[model samples]
Target: MESSSNFTPFLLFLSATLTVLSSVSANSEGDALYALKRSFSDPDNVLQSWDPTLVSPCTWFHVTCNQNNRVTRLDLGNSNLSGHLVPELEKLEHLQYLELYKNNIQGVIPPELGNLKNLVSLDLYNNNISGIIPPSLGNLKNLVFLRLNDNRLTGPIPKELVGPPNLKVVDVSNNDLCGTIPTTGPFEHIPLNNFENNPRLEGPELLGLVPYATNCS
Candidate 1:
């Protein structure tokens, strides 16, 4: 009779331990999402709808989650969010879609964004962001869509950006960027509009045909 009583207590203890471990794992994932949420400055309260107090980010509007309940998509396009791209966003390791197009965000693209290895689509077009495109973005091997058009960015387009094998759409028009456009990968098939409005840019065809003081060859 005494052995049965001891066995019952042991089973109860094991069950409690398993429950606590599951809760901790869920809390850890939630904390990671909360940290990224705190990075952005939502002036117009577009992201005000994102409440971390909720059980999971999956329940938040505009945020999509996977079967594991991890944040996978953040579509905030045309929401009028005005702020700098925060490096802390790298915390969302499972993020696949990050759409922030047609906003008023300013400042340089954060290099830390390269940490998102699973990212597939990153659209940040029609913003007022400036500065050079970070070469570190080449780390996203699964990226298919990347749009950075209609911004005030300057400097050379990183040749490293052409390394993504799955890259399909890349629009970087209407920027202040200068220098030669990459002649490899998806760049070779890109339309002329992709390189338009950048006064100092020299396309592949004009690289050797044009005669100028800059020596584009």
Candidate 2:
């Protein structure tokens, strides 16, 4: 029964709210990426385009975004970068492909990376990374390829990795990993060579013959 003009103010308020939300989302994503830029030693200025003053990381080089301006991929492989990864990377909720392979990056793989539920491929091979494979990575139900070979990592591969239903490929060889290889799930079809070369890692376990925990001790 009221006049239609009365709705104008409410509609304007709603529009402004949405704009603010979009800006905040963009800025937060930018901040998270900028934090990473600060953590790395980029000799080639491959990250020169990562200006934190920008409205969105979508405009940055090596960063891919979806139609909604949400980060989807980060391709910084082989860029001569050397530094640890930042935990802030978990903020990219829509991230899928995280490729930082064949670099000189050191330090542990941030456990927070497991929070990226949409992640598909995680390639950190041929780096200087050293740490346990985070069990938290089991949360990535959408993961497909995970390559962490040729690093200095030392620990048993978390059994949780065996849970991702879509995981088709995994290579953790040439590390210092200790323990029997997981025989279930995606590992069942994976080539044995993919898990070889770790001096302490053993088994495609013989059921009832060699227990799964035989080597870790």
Listed in order, each prediction's TM-score against the native is 0.80, 0.94
87-187 per-residue lDDT for model 1 (tens digits): 76786788999999998889999998899999999999999999988988888999999999999988877878889889888888998877777767877
User: All candidates: CA RMSD in angstroms?
Assistant: 4.8, 1.6
- Pull out the clashing pairs in model 2: none
lDDT of candidate model 1 versus the reference: 0.80
For each of the candidates, give the backbone clash count.
Answer: 0, 0
Tens-digit per-residue lDDT, 26-133, candidate 2: 888899999999999999999999999889999999999998898999999989999999999999999999999999999999999999999999999999999899
For each candidate, the alpha-carbon lDDT, in order, equals 0.80, 0.91
Off by over 4 Å in 2: 1-3
Most TM-score-accurate candidate: 2
